[model samples]
Target: MKKIICLVIAYGLVFTPLSILFSCTVEAKIVSASSVLSRQQAIDFVKKAQKNQWTLTEKDYFSLSKVKSTMNPYFTSAYINEFVNVGGKNTKSGWISNLRDTDDVTGYLPYDTPGKEMTVSYSKDKKKIYVTGYANSEGDIYKVTTTLVKTKVGWRIEAIKWL
Candidate 1:
C-alpha cells in the first residue's frame, strides 16, 4: 500500500540519520581519548618503572618490597612476590609493569555531550590525587579509579577501585 511505503520511508529518514549521528559520536570518543602522558609524568613514570623493572628482573626481592611499600593498600605485600615471580618467569603479567607502555590511555574521561576527559583531581588537603578512566558510553560503562597519596617516599597509589 502507498501508506505503508510512505511510513517505511519516513521511518527510514528519521532512523538513518539518528543511527549515523550515534555512530559518529562513539567514534569521536575513541579518537578523543587521552592516549599520551605529559612529559614530566612520563619521565617520572619511566624512572619508577625502570627502577622497579631492573630490581625485579634481577630478582632483588628486598628492593622490590621497598618499591611496593609506596603503593596503594589494595596492593598487599603478597603482590610484590607475585610480581617478582611473574617477571622472573617471563610471562605477560610482567608486561603490566612496563612503564614505556604507560601513555595517554592512562588518562581517560567519560565521553559526553560536552566531551571532557577528567584526568586528575586533588583532594582538599592536596595530599590525595584521584584519576578516573572509563568508556564514555550510555550503556555498560566500566570505570576505574586510582587514588594516590603523597608520602615521604613520594606520591604512591593508595587505592584502585573498579566501579
Candidate 2:
C-alpha cells in the first residue's frame, strides 16, 4: 500500500509541472495565432479584392451592375459602386484608369509580385483594419491603402484609396 502511494506521488510530481507548462504553451500559441491570423487575413483580403479591379473596363462588358456584383463580396454595398466606370473613361479618373490610364493590360498594382510590400494597422476597437502597401520598380512608385470593416459575415473592405 505504501509503495502504491509513493508511486502515485512520484507520477504526480513528474507529470504535474509538465501539464502546467503544456497548458501555458497552448495559451501562448492561441494568442499568437489570433494576432497573426488577423493581419494575414487583411493582407489576403486586399490582394484578392484588388485583383477584381479589372472588371471595371470595357472588354468584360463594363457594366456598373457587373462591377458591383464582382466587388460586393469584398466591399461594403455603399462603397462598391464607387469603383465602377464605363470602359475606364476620364483617363485620370476612376480606380483602374487613374493607375495605368488603360485597361488592355496590367496596371501598377503588381499583384502577387516581388515589388509589392504591405503592412497592417488596426483601429482602437479592432473593428477596422488598414492594409497599406506599395508597388515599386525602377523610378516609379505607387502606394495604396485598403480599409476593411469587420461585419457579421466577416471582414469587408470599406475603401481602396491610392496615394
Pick the lDDT winner.
Answer: 2
For model 2, the superposed segments whose C-alpha errors exceed 4 Å read 1-37, 55-60, 85-116, 136-139
Q: Tens-digit lDDT track for model 1 on 1-163?
A: 1122111212246436433221111222232112333435533443353344344223322344344553322233443445434433333333233323332222221222133343666677766667665543345556756565555545544454547
Q: What TM-score does model 2 achieve against the real structure?
A: 0.57
Cα lDDT listed for each candidate: 0.41, 0.57
Scored by Cα lDDT, where does model 1 land?
Answer: 0.41
Q: Pairing residues by index, what is the TM-score of model 1?
A: 0.33
Q: Count clashes in each candidate, considering only residues at least 3 apart in sequence or on different chains.
A: 3, 0
**For candidate 2, which ten residues in a row score worst on lDDT?**
1-10
TM-score for each model? 0.33, 0.57
Model 2 per-residue lDDT tens digits across residues 14-117? 43643322211122222332242377877887777767754454342344555567777787776754544432343232234433443222322344434556
Pairs that collide, model 2: none
